[model samples]
Target: MHGYANPARFLRLAKLLTAPLLIGGGLLAVAVLAWALAAAPAERLQGDSVKILFVHVPTAWLAMGGWSAIAIASLSELVWRHPLAGVAARAVALPGAVFAALCLATGSLWGRPAWGTWWVWDGRLTSMLVLLFLYLAYIALADAATRDGQGQSRIPAIFGLVGAVNIPIIHYSVLWWNSLHQPPSITAGKSEMAAPFLIGLMASTLAFSLLFGGVVLARMRAILADTQAEARLRRRAMNAADV
Candidate 1:
């Protein structure tokens, strides 16, 4: 993995792999969306509105998954000093934030019919909201630290590690409080969801995960190119000053 941290190596591999990744991700996304929205059975309670689960649940899952990736990458940057760790961490922030917002928005849309309100201060919802804010804060902190030349990698890396505390809080919120958001209906011990619904949920989860991976890879490549360009510019300026 560290060997691929070299920008040249990464670029070479990315160029080779880009077409396949794009094709696979696109196909999976389309297939999953079709299966989830069109083929899955309507819930006994929520009816067609349950189809929103295909989008909402997957976005929520990816939002957490993205943050976990950031936390792991940040840890690598701090401990292993991996050059690409910071890039990966920063690359994931925007998509994570967008997905977090999507999760909240879709949850609210689903809630209106189910919970009888557009918004609620319930434990799970509030914790998820905090997760969204954490994503925004991480992006803002990273952007500021980079622009001020106050050290780009270390500050945001530390912030990411610290902010990761929210992940557990969000996960356990339903268990710990009397929230409107129901506890996991598809638990290991008791599976309440029908087989078709569960299948759609799993497919959607896979599609979102693939989409997130492709997006992060694309963003990281762009960042590496920009960094290389900046270095070349600085070298040119130095050579001119010497002459």
Candidate 2:
């Protein structure tokens, strides 16, 4: 990890890995989605609406996973002074927020048919909404800190760490509260899903995970380049002032 602390090393790696991940992930996603939509049988109860699961589940997983990345990067920044940690956190914020929003939108669509309502203040849903708001807030705070020339500001890092508390709440919400949402279906070697659905879901998840990683790395590379350019301009200005 420390080896990646060098921006040049990291940028070279990001460049090499980005295209393969993006292309491979995109192909896998398209193929699995086609399979889920066309070949996979519908759920016994939900019928055709169950097809949404392939898209919704992956977005939901990535939403949580994205924030987890931010929290880890923030921790590294604060605790280890990892040089690229802030860049990593910034790189992930937008994608994470997008995924969270997608989760909310898709969940609402799924809920409308399954729960007979377009929206509900269920524990799991509500907590996930809060997670979206937290992402937006973090994005704003981080941007403000950066613009203020406090690039290494600990405020955003601290907030990132605190926001992680919501993750566990989101995970356990269904178990902890009376909700319309179902409990764990694929935990502890017990799965309610049949083989077809399970395979499709897993494939979609792997595809999205690859795509997400590529996006994060690409964004990190861009951020590093901008930071370097800014530093160079500042140095030139200081030298001109000295003259």
Candidate 3:
């Protein structure tokens, strides 16, 4: 991990991985989506409404996963002083927020048919909404810090770490509270879900995870480039002032 602390080396690896991840993820997503739409059998209970699981489940996982990444990176920045950690945290914000939004939208769509409503204030749903707000707040804070030349500030990192508390809450909400949201169909090496739906969900999850990783790397590279360009501009301004 520390070996790639050097930006040049990290950038090289990111360039190599970014394209493959995006391409592979895109192909896998199409395949999985098609399988979900056509091949996966309709659930006896939810019928066609179950189809959205392929999309919604993955988005929900990534939404939490993205924040988890931010939390880990934040820890690295604070404890290990990793140079790229802040970049990682900031880069993931937008994608994480996007997934959170998608999760909510799809959840609503799924619920409309299954739960007979477009929205619910259940524990799981509310916590997930809180996660979305956290992502937005982090993005706004990180962007403001960058614009104000406080990009290296510790505030955002602290927030990232603090916001992680909600992750467990989101996960255990359905279990802890009486909610319309179903209990986890998959658990410690066991699954109550039918085989076909499980298979499709897993495939869709992998594809979305790959897509998330690729986006994060691309965003990291962009953040680095912007920082480098700003540094160059600063040097020129200093030189001009001296003359």
Best by lDDT: 3
lDDT comparing candidate 1 with the true structure: 0.86
**Candidate 3 accuracy as lDDT:** 0.95
Error of 1 at 202 (Å): 1.1
Per-residue accuracy of model 2 over 21-44 as CA lDDT, tens digit each: 889899999999998878999888
| lDDT of candidate 3 at residue 204, scale 0 to 100 | 92
Against the hidden reference, what TM-scores do the models get? 0.94, 0.97, 0.98
Q: Least accurate stretch of 10 residues (summed lDDT) in model 2?
A: 144-153
Model 3 TM-score on a 0 to 1 scale? 0.98
Which structure among the candidates has the greatest TM-score? 3
Candidate 1 vs candidate 2: which has greater TM-score? 2
lDDT per residue for candidate 3 within 1-243, as digits (tens), equals 999999999999999999999999999999999887877888888998899999999999999999999999999999999999999999999999999999999999999999999999999999999999999999998988788776546889999999999999999999999999999999998999888888889999999999999999999999999999999999999999999
**Candidate 3 error regions (>4 Å):** none
Error in Å for residue 225 of model 3: 0.4
RMSD of each: 1.6, 1.1, 1.0
